[model samples]
Every structure is written in structure tokens, then in C-alpha cells.
Target: MKRIISQCSKELSQFKRDRLTLALAFLLPLITLFIFGFAIRLEAKNIPLVIQDYDRSPISQRYVAKLFATNQFIFVPWSVNDSVEIALDRAIAKAGIIIPPEFSRRIAAGNIADVQVLVDGTDSNNARVIKNSIKATTNDFMQSEGLIPETNLLTTRSRLWFNPARQESLYIVPGVYAVVLWIFPSLLSAIAMVREKERQTILQVYASSMTSTELILGKGLAYLIVSLGIALVVMGIGAIVFRLSFAGDPTPLLVAIPIYLWASVMFGTMLGTRTTNQNAAVQGVALVGFLTALLLSGFIYPLSNIPFPLSLLPNVIPARYFIEITRDAYVRGTGWIGVWFAELMIFAIGMFFFNVARRVLSKMQLTE
Candidate 1:
């Protein structure tokens, strides 16, 4: 037990001595929390809508005025009576409201008064919010005007699945688990390996009785154990301190720990295979970490919200899969059945990378 403590202590000392790495490990998650918390807001608020009131009637103007009067929407004056196409082409509006000449007459005669709303489908999230807001406002108009009774109105009670309240923190905090784990193990192993190699201490290890596999296991396990500890600490802080709920069974999350650590360790080993210095290794890990966690992990933005083939990007990114799994467990109370696929994928990819890294490391002379 003392020897194990001594080994871990030495590893921790080595970790603390890398000032850049230690700072990144401690600071990045907090920085990311602030950025994602404030900057990446998913809730669509005060979406701009353009008006093309062609009817020139008091009733039509009243409807248009009511739509803008709501704090939920901002009205940009667009008197494009002749050409709404031109307004849409100029990108001067997200949505355009068109009231026809017969609009007032239809409303007075107890007929269905339909106003055309053209939305810029380019920004789908904005479009969705605008559409729902319009529908809600119009429904209110119908009720107040006695077009329908309060109880007899054709009403749809919309409920958001999974995240019912649509708490952004619930979506984001679980994702941090993946990003945090992805960073530490790679950063630790890469820096540790590069430091020894740069200082020429690695050659002494080769002179010893340790095989390549034995050396990698010793180094990778040491980093993995430390990284896993940091991950759990972050999870606890996010849950207990931040009040972010881990709604699922604790067992699945515990099961995923090995998967996360192994993936990070293997990725770090791969980085170490290519890098000759600690700086290069750290930079490589950062680059990969940013791309995988920040851009593709379905953390900062929803995968469904992106356009074209770019939306498919998260599928290939391992961090994204793990993030999805963690979020499901954290926010939705999903069990092992929900997360097993992600665990398997992480294991498979981690094993593949480790084998490749091991083979490459075997060929290289540590003395070189």
C-alpha cells in the first residue's frame, strides 16, 4: 500500500511540475463552463421578424401590431408591398408577415382569416421558435375575439421530451465529463512521455528489464488513474455544487469510467508516438480535444441543428458518442442498456489505437 502511494505521489508530483498542463487541466473546464453557460444559449429569444403589410387596413395593421407588441419578438419595419422576395433575398429578415387586402373582410364576415408568414428556413432553430410564437399569439387572438370559446378551442399541449423544462445546463454539464476526461489522460501521458524522452531518461527505461507493453501499461495506467479521479471530481462538482442532476443509475456512469480513461490513454499514446517534445504533444492533444469536444461533441450546439453532412460529424467523433451517453444517464435516467453501445465503441476504438501505438512504440529505439 505504501509503494502504491509512493508511485501515485511521484506521478502527481510530475503532473504538478508541468505548469502549462496543470493550468489547462484546472482552468479549461471552468472556462468552458462559463463560455457554454453564457455564450452558447439554445433558447431562441427576441427573434427578429420582418413585416410586409400589403392590406393597408386597420384590422390587418392591428394583427401585425399585436405580433410585434409581444416582448418575445422584435419587429423590423419592412414595407415591401411589391416584393417580399427582394426582402428575403437581402437577408433583411428572418420571417416576413404578409396580410392580404381581403384579410379584414374575412375576419368581419366570420370566415377563416389566414395571414401568410414567410420564414427564412435557413436558420431552422429561429424558424421553429418564430413559428411557434406566431401560432401561440394567433391562438390568443382567436380566443379574445370570441372566434372560439376557452374550453372548445382546438388546443395542443406541447411538451418537450427528455429535458422537459429545456434547461441548457442539464445538456451542457454532462458533456463536460467527456471533454474533461478526453483532455487529462492524453495531456498527462503525452507530457509525461515527452518530458522523459526530451530529458533522455527514457533511454534508461529501455536499458531496464521492462518490455514496450510493460512500459506503456505502467505509464498509461498511472495517467489513467489520475485522470479518472479528476473526472469524478468534476462530475461531483457539477452535480452537488452546481445542482446539475445525474438522473440515471450510478452504475452505468461507474462502468463508463474505464471506457473514458482507456480512450484518453490510447489517444495520448498515439499523440506521444508522433510528438518529440512536451509542447508538441500538449498542442496535439489540445487540437484534437477542441475539435472533438468543443465542435463535434453535441455540447456547445445540437447535432440536429447543424446543416448538411456537417451534422453527421458527431457520429464519427468518439467524444460525441460518450457525451450523448453521459447526458442520457445524467439527464434522462437511462440505464446500462442506453449506454452500452457508447461504452463498447469507446473500448473498441481505444483498443485499436492502443494496439497501433504499441506496435509503433515497439519499433522506435527509446535511446534515439
Candidate 2:
């Protein structure tokens, strides 16, 4: 115990002695939090929609106003001489609408009329959002103005539960915690362990009285403390800037954070041992730790949406589970019952990392 503590102290001293590493440990997570918190939006808005109104009637004008009423879209003014096709070709707007001269006449006659809609499908998601927004807006306009067929219809009312305001930060910031925590701690520790190899100090440590377990524990413990500090600062800043507040029991996150962090640092330690140089270790962390946490961990894309064979990968991702804990803590507040399995999975993954590192280190103890 004393030896492990001493080793931890030694690692911490070395970690702080280097100014760059110290700055990276603290500053990087803050930068990532702000960037992701402000930049990523699940719900797209401010879409530029070009309108070519040939009718110029009051009803057609009202319909255009209704589209912009939700503030999801902004109208792009095109000159009378310019065609909607030209505006779309120039990439001036995401979508274009052609309101024909017969638009109001058809509605007045209670006849079906088709208004041409051309959407730029360069980004399928954005195009889909614009299409849906326009459809919903048009439906609302017809219903409010009593232009409907007046047939009985099935109506379902939707209440935006948990996040009524549809603030993207509420959903985005919690997942950002998972990605930032998973990346930096693992990154810092990977570089540190690889640096020991580059200096040939690991060989001396292996030959010393301190067993492989102590060294691993000490290094893990040191980086774990650094990981905690990173967590506190990153999460604190997320709360202040995003206006995030816990919606339910904070206990699930309190329990899951350390376990998740253990998985992160241990993952770094594993990468350090596998790679011969700091460069390889850094690449390994970025490719495995950063990519998996950012993409496969249900941060931006839903795990179910990830194509088959690839979808199975999220099962083992520690960040995937930690995201559940964090989002639950802030949004759902389902408590321990909601996230107990995620906590267990994170711990299991951490132990798996520790075991793998231990086996690797034990073999290396012979200095092979």
C-alpha cells in the first residue's frame, strides 16, 4: 500500500513537472466542452428556403408566412428574373418552393393542387428535416384556415416530455462529458506510460522491488486523480455554460463516473504497453479511445442506427454506458435502477483493462 502510494506520488510529481502535459490535462477538456456544447445541434434550424411565388395571392402569402412562423426556416429573396432552379443550382438555399398561379384558385374550388418543392439532397438529414418542416407547416396552415376536406381524422397529440423546450444543449452536453472524459485521461496516461518506455525507465522499474502490480496501480491511481480533476472542471463548466441542472437523483452519475474513468485510464495504460513509442501510443488512443467514444458511444448517432456488425461494437464501449448514466442523471433521473447495468458494465470493462495490463506486465517482469 505504501509503495503504491509512493509510486502514485512519484507519477503525479512527474506529470506536473512537465508544463505541456499539465496544461493538456486541464485545458483540453474545457475547450472540447465549449466547442461541442455550442456547436452540435440535434434539431436543425435557420434553414435557408428560397420562395418563388407566381400567384402573389393573399393565401399564398399567408402560406409562406406560416412556414417561417416556427423559425425553423428563413426565406431567401430571389429576383423576379432569377428562377428557383437557378437559386437552387447556385446553392443559395437548402430548399425552394414554387407557388403556382393556381394555388389559391385550387384551394378556393376545394380541388387538390400541387405546389412544386425542390430540395437539395446533398445532406440527407438536412433535406429530410426541411421536407418535414415544410409538410408540417403547410398542414397547419390548411387546418387553421379551414381548407381541409372536413373528414373525420385520427389525431394524436404529442407532448415534448423531459425536454419541453427542445434545447439541444441539454441532450448534447451530457454526451460531450463521456467523449471528453474518455479521450483526455486515456490520452494523457498513454503518453506518460509510453514516455517511460522511450526513456528506458520501465526496464529499471521492472527490475526493482516494486512488482508490476504496484507500478500499474500507482500509474493508474495518479492518472485517475488527474482524471477526476478533469471531470470536475469539465462538468462544472458544462453546468454553468449550458444551464444544465440535474433532473433526477444524482447518485447514478456519482457512482458511475469513477468506474467509467477507471476504464478510460486503464485503456490508456493498455495502449501504452502495446505501443513502442509515444507517437504510436497517441495514435492508438485517438483511433481506439477517441473514435469509439465519439462515434459508437451514442453521442451523436443512435447505437441502433449504426449498421449491423458495427452496431455490436457499442456493447463493449465504456463511453456508451457512461453516456446513459450522465443523460439519466441530468435528463431522465431514472436513479440506480435505470443505470445499474451501465455502472456494472463500466466496472467490468475497467477490470478487463486492468487484467489485460496485469497479464502483459507480469510477462514483461521477466524483461522479455
Candidate 3:
């Protein structure tokens, strides 16, 4: 026990001695939380909208005013000064409302008329939301002005829930935590362990009575604790500084964290054994981390949106489950019942990799 404790202390001391790794250990998670939380918001609000009103009539003016009055549209322009197509092409605006030259003249004549709306389809999600908001806004204006069809049609309206304000931060913050934590812990551990092997430190331990399992466990555990501390700090900054709301209970997040940390350390161990230099280790971590985060994280394109076979890919990505567990606890506020399967999977993967680590390290020949 004393020897293991000494080994752990020495490992941690070695970790602290490296300024870059130490700074990354503390700073990376916080930086990821802030960047992903603010940048990748789920809800589309205040999208830039342009109006090309050619009619110059009271009814058209009223329509324009009503559209701008809604908080949804950031009305950047209110004239047909620039072409609608050009505005969209230049990405200056998302949606364009073009009122016909005879809009008010026809309204005065009690003739039913329609306006042409041009929406930029660059971002499908943004396009969808802006189109929906504009449609609702227009429909409401028509109803208020009694512009109803003589043939009545039944209509249904559905309200979006949970993220009532449609704030992107709500959806993003939880996922950000999962991706950043997943990458940092595994990358750090992989490099750290490999560095020990390169320095002949693993040989020194093996020369003593320490088993390969003990060496791996000691190294993995120390990194896991460090990861937990970093997770807490990242969560704190997200909740306090960025004003991200964690709606769910924290018990599931607490429970699932160590499981994730374990899996990460095991993965790091696997990578560490494969790489030759610190550069190779860092590169391996970055490549795997970015690719896994992009494909498996379910932050950019949702798992449901992907094809059936591709959805299975997320299961292999540890961060995907971590995101699920984090969202269940923080957003839905659920307990073990909500995320038991994810917790189990992480544990199973961790154990599987640990076994592999034991085998690999036992066979590994290190020199003094």
C-alpha cells in the first residue's frame, strides 16, 4: 500500500512538473465548455432577416412593422435597396420578405394576394426555424386583419417544450462537458503512461514486486482522480460563469463520471502502449479525440438523423454515452433508472480494456 501510494505520488508529481500538460489539464476543459456552450447553441433565435418592400403602401408597411416587431427577426434592412437573391448569396441575411408592387393596392381593392419569401437554405436547421417563425408571424397578422379563406381548414399548433426559450446553451453545455472530458483524460493518461515507459520507470516498477495490473491500476486511478477534479471545475465554470442551467439532479452525473474516467484511462493505456514518442501519443490522442467527438458525440448531427448502421457507431464512442448520461442527469434530472445501461456499458468497456492492458503490459519488455 505504501509503495503504491508512493508510486501514485511520484506519478502526480511528474504530471505537475510539466507546465503545458498541467495547464491543459486545468484549462482545456474550461475552454471547451465555453467555446462549445456558446457557439453550438441548439435554438435559432434573432436570425438576421431582410425585407424588400416594393409596394410602399400602408398595408405593406404594417406587415413589415409587425414582422420586425417580433423579437425573432433582427431586421437589418427594410427596403428593396439590395436584391433578395444577392442578400442571401452574400449571407448577409437568412430570410427575405419581398412585398409585391401591387400589395397595398390589391389589399385596398379587397383582393387576396401573396408575397414571395426567399429563405437561405445554407443552414438547414436555421432555415427551418426562421421559416416556421415567419410563417407563424404572417399567419397571426392575417388572422388579426381578417384575411381568412372562405373555405375553412382545420389547423393544429404544437408548442415546443423543455428548452422553452430555445437557448442553445441548454443543449450544448451538457454535450460539451462530455466531449472535452472524454478527450482530455484519455489523451493525458495515454501520454503520461507512455512517457513513463520511455523513461524506464515501468521497468523499475516491474523489477520490484509490482504486477502489471497494479502498475496500470495505480496510473489509471491517479489520472481518473485528476479527471474528476477537472470535470468539477469545468462544470463549475459552466454553471456559475456562463450561466448554464443544469436542470436535472447531479447524482447520475456524479456516478457516471468515474465510469467514464476509467474507460478513458484504459483507452489511454492502450494508445500509450502503441505509440513511440510523446509527439506520436499526442497526435494519436488528437486524431482519435477529434474524429470520435465529431462522429460519435451527437452534438453536430444527432444520432437519430444518421442512418441506422451509423447510429451504432456512437455506442463505441465513450463520449456519446457520457453525453447521454450528463443530459439525463443535468437536463432531465433523472437518477440511475435513466442511465443504467450507459453506466453498465462504460464499466464493461473499462474492464475489457483493463484486461487487455494487463496482457499487453505483462508481455512488454522494458530496459533500465
Candidate 4:
């Protein structure tokens, strides 16, 4: 017990002394959190809209006025020669609203009126939002003017389940858990173990009375505690700055986080065991762990959209499972039953990496 405590204390002291690791563990994550939290916006607002009203009627003018009155769209100047396609192609407008000469005539005769909407489909999400906003606005105008009878229309009062306001920050901020979990612990463990090899101190540890399991645990525990502290700080930032809510029971998060941290630490220990150089360890952590988490963990992009063979790659990535668990816990407010499979998978992966690292260290000790 005393030896394990000493080993833990030694690792903590060494971590404090190494300025680079300290910065990587603490500072880099906070900077990234701020950047992603404040800068990345998913909601489309104030879209440039081009209006072509051939109908010189009061009704057409009223419709145009209603559309421009909302914050969702800004009317851009349009000329008679400028076609909807031309306006969209030239990037002068995201969407073009064309009112025909018969728009008021058809409405006055109690007949259906058609309005042409030309939208740039380059960005699908933005296009969808624009279309929905236009549909809602038009419906509201029609209802108010008695153009569309309330009895004839079926209204859907859409209650957004998890995020009521449909704020993008709510969707994004919770993902910080997966990002921080991937970067900090892995980098810290990799650098710490590789530093030992670089300084030829690993030999001294192997020769000491401390068993390999004790050595691994002592180092792993120190980083695990630090990583949890970082996670708490990040959660606070998410709650305070981004207004992220934790509506669910925290039991799943509490259960999953330590296991996920262990998996990351074990994976890092494996990387450090395989590589003898600190530069190579750092690079490996960046390429294998950090980049993989960022790209394939379903953090920024949906896994379904990724093409086959490549899509299967995320199954092996620990961050992928952890991100799902986080979203389930933080966003959907799902309980242990919802996340139990992912927790089991994380534990399995952690044990696999821990065994591999143990074997590699044992082999290295024998060679020495």
C-alpha cells in the first residue's frame, strides 16, 4: 500500500514538474472548449432572400412584407432580368421568393395560389431550416388573412423533445465530454510513460519492489483523478457558459466516466509501451486517439453518413462509444439501462488494452 501510494505521489509530483504536460492537460482543453462553445453555430439566421414580385397587388406586397419582417430572412435587391437560378448561382441570395402575376387573382377567387421558392441546396441543413421557416411564415399569413381556413389545415404543435428552443449550443456543448476524454488522459499517460523511457528511469522502476500492476495502477489512478477534475471543470463551463442541462440522473455518467478514463489511460499506456520516444508517443496520441475521436467518434459528423468499410472504423474507437453514452446521459437523460451496453464495451476494451500493455511491459523488463 505504502509503495503504491509512493508511486502515485511520484507520478503526481512528476506531472506537476512537467510544464508541457501540465499545459496539454489543463490549458489546451479550456481553449478548445471556448473555441467550440462560442464560435461554432449550427443555427441558420438572417438568410439573404431575393424577392421577385411580378404581381403588382396589395396581397403580394403584404406577403413579401411578412416574409421580410422576421429575423430569419433579409431581403436582397433583385432586378427583373435576374432569374432565381442566376441569383442563387451568383451567391447574391440563399433563397429566391417569386410571386406570380395571378397570385392575388387566384386568392381573391378562393382558388389555390402558387408561390415559387428557389433555394440553394449546397448546404442541406441550412436549406431545410430556410424551407421550414418560409412554410411556417406563409401558413401564419394565410391563417391571419382567412386565405386558408383553420378547419381545413391540420396543425402540428411541434414540441422539440430534448432541446425545446432548438439551440445548436445545446447539441454541441455536451460533446465536449468526448473531446476532453479523448485528448487529456491519453496524452498525459503517453507522455508520462514515454518520458520514463526517454530518461532511462523505466529500468529503475522495473528493478524496484513495485509489481507491474502496481506501477500501472499507481500511474493510471493519478491521471484518472486529474482527468475527472478536468471533466468537472468542463461540465461547469458547459452549464454556465453554454447553458447545457443535466436533466437525467447522473448515475450513468458517473459509472461510465471512470471506465472511459481507464480505457483511455490503458490505450495511452499501450502507446507509450510500444514507442520509446516522447515525440512518437505524442504523435501517436494525436493521430490515433485525438484525430480519431474528432473525426470518427460521431462528435462533429454523423456516423451514418460515413461510407461503408470506413464507417466500421468507429466501432473500434473508444471515443465513439463514450460520445454516445455522453449524449444519452447529458442530452436525452437516459438511465443505466440505456447506456449499459456501451459501458460494458468500454470495460472490455479497457481490459484488452490493459492486458496488452502489461504483456509488453513484462517483455521489456525481461529483455532488460
- After superposition, which runs of candidate 4 have C-alpha atoms over 4 Å from their true positions? 153-157
- Candidate 1 lDDT over residue span 69-165, tens digit each: 7777787776664566667778876777777778888888988877888887888877888898898888777676677766855668787768887
By lDDT, the candidates rank as 2, 4, 3, 1
Ranking by TM-score: 2, 3, 4, 1
When 2 and 4 are scored with lDDT, the better candidate is 2
Please provide, for model 4 over 1-368, each residue's C-alpha lDDT reduced to its tens digit, 9 standing for 90 to 100: 77778888999998888887778887888888888877777678889999999997998999998998888899899896778889899898999999998999999998889999989999998999999999989988998798766685666777778867677776676676787777788888988888889899988988877777778888888888878877877777667887766768878878888899889998898899899898999899999888888889888889998899899998888888887787877678877878888889889999998998888888888787
Q: Is 2 or 3 the stronger prediction by TM-score?
A: 2
lDDT of 2 by residue, 214-252 (tens): 999999999999999999999998899889999989988
The sequence of per-residue lDDT tens digits that candidate 3 reaches over residues 62-156 is 88888988877897764456688888888888888888898977877898778998999978888888888889888988887778774578877
Model 1 alpha-carbon drift over 4 Å, by segment: 1-9, 51-71, 77-93, 100-102, 112-114, 121-125, 132-136, 143-158, 240-242, 278-283, 286-289, 293-317, 365-368
Which candidate leads in TM-score?
2
Which candidate leads in lDDT?
2
Q: What would the TM-scores of all predictions be?
A: 0.78, 0.97, 0.90, 0.89
State how far residue 368 of model 4 sits from its true place (Å). 1.8
Candidate 1 lDDT at 186 equals 78
Model 4 residue pairs with clashes = none
